[model samples]
Target: MLGMPVTSFGWSVNLIVYLIEEFNIKSIAAAQITNIVNGCLSMLPVVAAILANSFFGNTPVISVSALISLLGIVLLTLISFFDNLRPRPCETGSILCNSPSKLQFGILCAALALVTTGSAGTRVTLASAGANQYEKRKDQGSFFNWYVLTVNIGAIISATAIVYTQDNVSWKLGFGLCAAANLISAIVFISGKRFYKHEKPMGSPFTSLLCVLVASMVKRKAVISSKEEDYHNRGIGKEAKPSVSMPSKSFRFLNRAALKTEGDKKPDVDSIKNIWSLCSVQEVEDCKSVLQLLPLSLAIIFVTTPIVTQSSFMVLQALVTDRGLGPHFKVPAASVQVISIISSCIFIIMNNWIVYPLYHKLTHKPLTPLQKVGIGHVFIVVSMAVSAVVEAKRLRTVENEDHMSVLWLFLPLVVVGIGEAFQSPANTDFFYGEFPESLRNTATSLISLVFGISFYLSTALIDLIQRTTKWLPDDINHGRVDNVYWVLVIVGVLNFGYFLACSWLYRYRNLQGDNEQDPKDIIT
Candidate 1:
């Protein structure tokens, strides 16, 4: 529901402009309010994620959020239907010209925020929860691949369907359809709960890992070398003092004293073995290994953020492009996302069917997650460079009073989608492989946090540039968006360099193999 409205809003920017012209209202003021609504809504995912991790868990959170989103969609539909009854000038015949009272608009904003909060929670929790189910099964690798595939399926469907609805009907219908879809998803989820594995909130895994590492450090420090002398000692060996031996007594008396009582049997061999293992120095090193890697994993999140912006920002760019296919047919601007979706599907097929198998056959090495991530970065950089060229062409086109072909935009989008298909799946695999079982959910959340923060940062940068730059024109088509594209180019290049650094750093580090014993299992 939230995504559909957001997509529609991007398409309807021109519609908002038309509303201003028709209603003779302060356009900038309305635009500001809308921007605030969008930004605040975007933050819903973070809040939802926290709630899923801390309190409600996935099922209840997703269910409740879907219902709330449905209500919000209903409200929007009502607002649309009642447009003619509201007081407003109608010069351009825009839907928003049916100027509902400021109070009505405020209510709409409130409802949208409510929808956002619910959608955000659902988005954050659902995928992880699905993945968690796979962990209970032994052959989880294939399950996870399917999980990622399913997400893409939903995204592809939503992008196409919502855009089609908005173009063919109205924004209200598009949003209402999304709300209905979410409600159905909620019902299906509830029905399937018994078939799935449920997860309990384990208090922050990062904290737990840190605690174990600190304890290990303390234990290591407390160990005193038997060979080292104390400050008071000058030449004496610490544990080599000579002692006189005189004992010659029989042990029969001690054997009588050591006879077992009713409660005492042979000592449990397994328990003694466990205690011995826990006290070993190797165990301490294992804990330290986990501690050392977590921060590094956190660092990877920042690098992963830009990959996602392909979908978010690309959708925004498509809105301003002219998309007439022929004399009587015009593609909806938002429908350009279908290119990315199709490209992603193709990429997945090529990788799974050809690329990975060919690589394994030629090199006799299974594809490593880091290697996959590195490859993903290469694609992302290429995509960004392609985008920069397109933007530059667009700039030139504007200067010469010529329109650039929409196909130019499609090329970069396709490249970026392929990059995402590689990066997202590899990133998910990396998290699962790198983190211990106890910390899987938390690790997943950290991944989500990286994505969330990246989007927040990207938007902030976009808004900052738009507000600060005198080069940008007040009109949409006439603006210096090329500069923004160039900035994205720089960011993408930096991301590629960062990934290379990470790959080099990771190569020297010892990673645990899939069959390696967990520290907790080894100790206990």
Candidate 2:
């Protein structure tokens, strides 16, 4: 939920800035409204996560979030309608005049934020949660691959169609379309409840642990009581004699010798009795089993962050590049995302169909999640290098007063998309596979939290660059975004190197085996 909004917010924030400049709104007011909207909207995932883990359970939580998203879509459409209906102050010789009440603008911003909260918070998280309903870890990987594919599909279609419609037709139509799409998504999710695993919320983990401990203690006590009863029935009462109350002389001597060798203090009778109890067996093993994956999960999060930069910094760079298709036509700035979508689709097809088959045939070895992630890092490095080259070419073109074709930018997008396909699916697979069944949703949320943090970091980096550099000077094409692209290239290279080091360190680490029941039968 959080990560999707981070991507959507990137576009929406830029869109808000564009509206402010185009409509001559006060910059302070515009920024305030955008920030308010983003702040509220960003909280949805946390809300969804809480609700899913507390009361609603995964299915109901997902359904509610989807419905909320649909409402948000409708609200955005309303905002666009109102904007269109308002009289143009520019045409009335009041270009600098305040027309729409600031209160009205504030209300609209609030509504936008509300819509985002539902769409971002509920919809995104639920979709991922739904994917976890899969039975086997291998199936979980397949499910996540499809989940990532669906998201890119949405981005691709939205970028191509929404950007074109907003630019050429009407912003109202563009927003209305998204709203309608949300409604459709809501319906689809609601219908799928019967097919999803119906695991109820487990409540607080601390409380659950306490309950388990208490239950084990009770079981231990019951067993000890039964043993005492058995001894009494056998007429071996404690008052009868010390030897009668205990065991054979040889056994007593062995026990005394063992206790003496371990410590000088005599072992307690209750402690010895408790040693024969079986209640602690499962509990201790369970705790150890879950703890085994902590290091692996942390490592996965570290590697996952750089891939997330694609939607943030990379999209921002694409907006500034010269994309004139011909003399009369210019490429829609947001449509550049379609290149990644196409590239991702192609890579997915090729990886499943040709690449994996060829590798299996040649080596007679199946690809492991770690190996896949390692390959993904290699592609990430290559993608960044390709981006650097593209940026370098663009820089030269801008300096020489020459026009570069929009087709040139496609090269980098394609490279990045291929890299994304290589890494994202593999990363998702690795995280899901290594986690225990009980922690699936929590584990997924943790992965998403890392992604969210990465995006915030990227956004902060961009803002810092803008503030510190002369890149955004008043007359420099509204702040030379080219510098931003260069910065991304440098960051991407560093991320690639970091991931390589981590992958190397993790090469010999053992992954947790899959133990969860398959989701298929549970759902059916």
Candidate 3:
């Protein structure tokens, strides 16, 4: 939780600056590279989660991942400490600047690959592993909430301390600090091995979904027979409609999971829990809920795209805008993004203690996770609109031959941080609470997957804007960035409608037997 994100985000927070300044990469190319790197980082967790659930257990994967991460960080530090490991320093905007040689690029790519693989292994796996230590869903939810908080705290430290060091002191010292953190955290994790709960590995939840589909197809005729008998008998038949129960009736065909068989064993200590056989109602509901969660997840991806895109642009804005704080100090542009992290932390605490509690007190009910996500949608729209306004003002300042204060960028980013506090933890709670025990590991990885998709999509969107429109020139000041923000504002509006439709139709799954059910028949 603590060490892994610190290492990854240490590079992530200032990666564009590092690429642009150190390797002489173009500004837009640097941003695309950063997004691509992060997208891959965000994605590898799903693979790691599948491995943890289906094959190698969490401990071995995490243990190996930590060592790999340590090595990658060490390599990156070497690149920073030794000038010969990277391209020599180049003049700003010089046409004669040398590009990195193939060997230098290869070494950088290898180090990054190791880091991404290692970091992905630990992230969501550790969340599930920690949550597994708890039997109660409430306790599990609390653990995951704190898991997210811990990650954000690591990001905050990375963006503030590590970024400041990278910008103001030396990249060598900064990257060395990241390597040290990775090593220390790995030692701490390994030392606590004996105390950790080692759950029996369940087969992948994804396979469970497939089995559900197969089961339904095999029993597709059963549903037809039941309906026919009830119709012919005029409601007096023994099979009379099968009177749907715990799993609900929306996908009644899928309820084939609980269908009785001639050779079925009693719901007992053994046989009935077999993964390859008929399943219980609880397992049936689990698969259905996962299906139900799909649209909401897709809605989230689209709603969040604009915000993710703006986040990259904000760093670029800070770079060009005035960062001077006083006669002697200037704020590091990378550190400017930390405003979102700080505000997210503050709002997380506030929602836990203040906002949510106050709402519950006044309304006599707790705010739902869906509502929290909706609030995030509204705030991000406002943030984009605010960014557009701010950018327009900045462009005017540029036109008038003055540098706009970087402080002008603060308000929208703070709003973005506030929106994150609403969206992300609630997202975690929603999936963790609603998803069945068998799929918990996969559930925890959902947010990471969403980021993976959005980062990739956002990069593509940025490229399209750069190519088809005149909005994203190398010199952002000379481009129509405000227009880009406006386009994002429109995107936010359209996605909110889709989100609302999904929310309006979505049903909360029953959680009564979630923790107790054997997940043998489960799929993620």
State which candidate has the highest TM-score: 3
Q: Which is the winner by lDDT between candidate 2 and candidate 3? A: 3
Indicate which candidate wins on lDDT: 3
lDDT of 3 by residue, 472-520 (tens): 9999989988998899889899988888878878766543354333322
TM-score of 2: 0.70
Clash pairs (backbone) in predicted model 3: 205-523, 205-524, 206-524, 208-523
- Which residue ranges in model 2 land beyond 4 Å of their true spot? 1-47, 84-105, 122-133, 206-321, 326-329, 472-490, 504-524
Global CA lDDT of candidate 1, please? 0.54
Which pairs of residues collide in candidate 1?
Answer: none
Q: Give the local distance difference test score of model 3.
A: 0.80
Q: Residue 234 of candidate 1: its Cα lDDT? A: 13
Best to worst by lDDT, what's the order? 3, 1, 2
- Give all candidates' CA lDDT scores: 0.54, 0.53, 0.80
- Candidate 3 ranges beyond 4 A from true positions: 218-222, 225-247, 256-281, 510-524
For candidate 2, give the lDDT: 0.53
Q: Enumerate clash totals for all models, in the order shown.
A: 0, 4, 4
TM-score of each: 0.72, 0.70, 0.89
